[model samples]
Target: MSSIWRTMRGIIAATALLATGLGTVALPAQAQKVLHRGNGAEPETLDPAKSSGVPESWLQYDLFDGLIMPDGKGGFFPAAAEKWDISPDGRVYTFHLRRNAKWSDGTPVTAQDWVFSWRRLVDPRTMADYAYFLWQVKNAQDITLGRKAPDTMGVRAVDDYTFEVTLASPTPHFVTMLHHHSTYALSKANVEKFGADFVKPGNLVTNGAYMLAEAVPQSHIKMVKNPHHYDAANTRIDTVFYYPTENQEAELKRFRAGELHFTYEVPVSQMQWLRENMPAELHTAPYFGTYYYAPNLTREPWKSSKDLRLALNLAVDRDILVDKINQRGEIPAYSFVPPNTTNYTQQIPDYARWTQAQRDAKAKELFAKAGYGPGGKPLELEILYNTQENHRKVAIAVASMWQQKLGIKVTLNNQEWKVFLSTRDEKKFKDITRHGWIGDYNDANNFLELLRGDIGKQNPSAFADPQFDLLMAEANTTSDTAKRATLLQQAERLMIEEMAVMPLHFYSSRHMVSPKLIGWVDNLQDHHPSRFLDVKP
Candidate 1:
């Protein structure tokens, strides 16, 4: 017994030495709680300005934090900015940086760093898709449009630690808008020194809970806790490993094998099995997002044919999509906006209430009017979707429905995430595309603004309407809550009537969490940042 005890003590002492001395060595979970998370796809870029996907956003949440972080209760708390103040009119905001907040290079995070980052986000050279988000800030849109110089924008560094922002209008949700990853500050010195290569793992200077220790494409991305992080002493998980798991079945297998602590999403086909077997681990709840199929309206033959767009939308069997394919409690979506949006009502179109048979008949009639039917040109098209098993299943099911019901010839085109985004953004695809948008903020504008003409790459459907835009613009800036709601409803009704997209279903987040993982709480946003998650020792 005395010899065994001595051996155990030596082993424990050596393990401690390895953890401290070998910085990149991954320690056992018993000694250091490491989280292995299964991400859905390979992240396109870690550069916050160039990222537009959920996978990249998840990494950003840990690798970089903005002025304030969401508190998960429809509120926020200070992050890089230790405290803040708002003006009486709510148009101006002031942020006080934490004195202890330092970048990975041991440099203090100053207010000037934020100004440079914000200006770069809207600069035309950067080509950031989320640039529309900052239009609320004074002169931000002008700078983005090249009408004004970058430094002329509203954000200013009052001092080394003080940052002030003046908005174009009294935006009540302006502070909420600041919580997005796009607003996260990048070190000016680092960018000036490294240029485009700054995003490389070794060159990146992060100011969050974790730093990019290594990234291996299609395999795993390894991140270690940042010693310079303001709250590093309080952070629970010492290391995080994210795996690119596009295959749901394979991800589930790994989970059962105890290789993964969490899954990005569960396979819909295995919903029943998960419920019966991993009831405690299988979590399904309402998510603030919508899944839809959009037609490219930029060029023919979809360009001059509104009837064709309406016909395609009517032919879709949304009920089957929700109840059959995605059976994890997803709601059949009719409007572009999710009904979960606070204090807002979804504008359900007239065709939504019609039975499948009724919709099919109407679709046939519309197809005939649009110069396609049994005696006319044969209707054929393709749907482009990113590489995912669930998306493939949905494309196959929906194609069958169109072919059998409306005699429309349909084909499916699948591409990896990065390629698919480029195809969709460039409007290179001739037919329909499957797209999903998870809300960034709780407000209705967060979802509705995607269809705006000036939204850049996000507006893949080419939905441009002056009246719709006018209504939304007023709704976006109005201080009167009642008037804003009315305007938003009008814009949505108009867009739905115009057939901007075929709404399939509202997403219900279905993920598997290991029992060993703690501090897990379900939320509508479906955001679980690493700082709040922990692994049991």
Candidate 2:
């Protein structure tokens, strides 16, 4: 931090360059503020309209600016939009864009860009898992289903700088949802010119603090500061490199070797070792997400066998899995929604009060009833998860438990992130696949909507109970807080009773951050943008 230390460090760096015979030492120059980050997986896409996973959001949030952006306090504040107004009924919102806001190409970012991007989001022709996120908007669902025109889907450019949106009904958390990548605006001109290839590094015109510099599948993504960004003058991080380190152990090694300033996740396998050795670098905080296994209900007994579903769901010891495997301070999940969600009551499962022995006994009884235990034929189930060390450990533990207690064979299948995503969606009886869903916002609706009886890729369980769907629909229409909470609670209970998806553990962010990295604040959503971070000497 002292000027003398900085000068000495520069001399040491110059001496090292001379020692290596790379080049002659010259006048010192300003250091480039670059951050090498260990991203968990390769991003599926850079296009905001089609991005589905956290890895993709990490890049998209840096390259695109929505009307609002995360204020890093578990809430949103104006970004592209300078200010906004809401109607008294809260059914409509109008955002006033900054006249100075410009894309990476120096073109003005207008309200029309948002209108076009939103229309594409709900348009059936454009494939995206999060398209249904905008279903609360008036006619958005109808447009998605091709029952209405795209222009009729409730958003419009009132002028070059003013964007207006209308919802079918009042949504209290709608503004909060605007910070998600699915709601970010894109340049219509850029998309129209290059079509689907507009997201390529040389073609993309980003509006956020960074622009795509290079992209290599499975290797790394490079981004540099955008000079034309609205707040470019204040942006600190000049360059960022995101390495797809799905292997948590390898990622931690890279962090220890000083290759990465930060990591997406610290390997749970190395939790104790990290705590003992690098206590200052280890950053763990409560995260708004849930890890679970979704059964492929489109195939075999899973479609009709409630007993089979319940047996498998009740068999897993969530307590042991959380306490033993994930020592990163995660809570056992008995419900789909994470605990402490804003204004939402936690939905406890029916078997929550039962002892582990009682649950196991019940699971054995149900497995036998479903024709799979002592009396019936053997059942072999395969659990598919991405190639992450934590996932593998959890799968091996669960398989071992099932083999020991229930007298059934369990197979573990591991695939790369992209392949695993595609394989899980294949309509076959893949049995079960490991999945994690981080909340887009603080509302319980954000968590519950993943199971909505729709044909979207987000609904991996293929759960389509008409009664359960009705409860969620009613909750959507209910404006009163107490009534809505009751409706959502009933819906969550219904899903658990039916064993639609097996609940695992609620997430806690586990990252290893360098002490030199300043302005890295922890929040419920676990969102930390590179623009806000600065490095010290």
Candidate 3:
């Protein structure tokens, strides 16, 4: 009986060791499989040409192929195109396609698709708000403005697989721009098949690693792997589910309940608990963007006095807001462009550099200058803020500060995001509106270019300056990086000096992920998760 017991123990020990070895063994040829992703918002549209939201853009990247795509490490790589070349004058670009690439429909992807997609984007009839992104392409502005026909636009199909494009100038970032969803290709057949309903989940065709399996408006969206994809071997995930919960607390709850694989915006209130319990799961990255108060410069009281704007800018304590209201990892911003952005220099001069006490004094002096003071003539203004808790808290804090320091009565108006955007677009808000601008790319041009009256005129801010416009134009055309940086820095200084917009804080996003997830990296330029690169258990 003792001999039998010893034999049994030895057999069990050997089996356990063998199992451990198999678990750790590396396979040279077999590809790892499947990843599941959770999103905080439902995609508005899957059609690459129309999708503008971050969630939509993320899914679009996996469903469609662009001429070029960012590798999430600062460089652009060919996607549909196997190779590309630039002309000596930098006016023309030619793309060569890979022979193996094909659409999910099994049709050969041709240059004609590229030509059609480009023309469609710039067509005034399409009314693509994002068409401005393609301005570097030759004749794009002309096509958008109805000055030229779509065919006259400088993109053409040289052959079934070769595409050619002409640019108005030597844009070094042109390839990087192509990586954006605005440059994604769409099939003419799919467009015709679904017509206006092409973006509908069931009706759409995918050329990416996954296809939209289901999408319920404002609720959830699910995507399943595309077996017909060109690189199916690399695509591990069978399905991805997106839940559009706006509440940060609710997202964290779902994450803790094991219902969500990841949550992007962890609530500031839970930061301490998360740090103490699961520090390894927490991730943070500087978002290349700014949150600011866009004063309606074209309207009454605010428009009448530059000092009033300067006073208001000085009155708001950015440090307090960052530390108290937004406990999330946000940096106090003194300038429009976030630090570390390409072509950005910290040399830009800040206008309102007053300390807390000095700021209060300045606010009082400005109120008195405007013919209003504490217990005297009351200056009542409505400050608009988003419905988000953090935004509302910041608004309340600013409102309280104005009341306490400047003796101004500020009424806080909180609205849902969609309504707030619509109200701002209508330009009906004559006082001030809170807004945030997340960078579309890694360039300072993303933030700096928005302030240009040419772009802002359509959505005009209350303030406009010819000098600022001229400086930006000079910077835009100059190929020399140092010269352009200097010009942009000068323009930023002038903007802050003029009190054009009250710069508040630059965002830093935090995420909580399950231990099972891996290969995910935080992108500072855009917070959207790179679904293609991440792997899950």
Q: Sort by TM-score, best first.
A: 2, 1, 3
TM-score of each: 0.94, 0.94, 0.87
lDDT of each: 0.87, 0.86, 0.73
Best by lDDT: 1
lDDT of 3: 0.73
**lDDT, residue 275, model 3:** 83
When 1 and 3 are scored with lDDT, the better candidate is 1
Q: State the TM-score for model 3.
A: 0.87
Per-candidate total of colliding backbone pairs: 0, 0, 5
Task: Return model 1's CA RMSD, one decimal.
Answer: 4.5
User: For residues 1-537, could you state the per-residue lDDT of candidate 1 as single tens digits?
Assistant: 234236557888998899899899877755666798889999989999889888998898889878987654445688998888989888888999998999988899999999999999999889998888888989998888889988888999999999999888888777777778898999999999999999998999999889999999898898999999999988889889898988999999888887788899899889998889889999888998999988898877787888988887888888888888878899988898897787688899888889989998999899889999888898789999998889999999999988987788898999999999999988888799999999888888888898887777889698898988999889878888888989989998988888877788999888899999987777888778787889885
lDDT against true structure, model 1: 0.87
Consecutive 10-residue window with the lowest summed lDDT within model 1: 1-10
Ordered list by lDDT, greatest first: 1, 2, 3
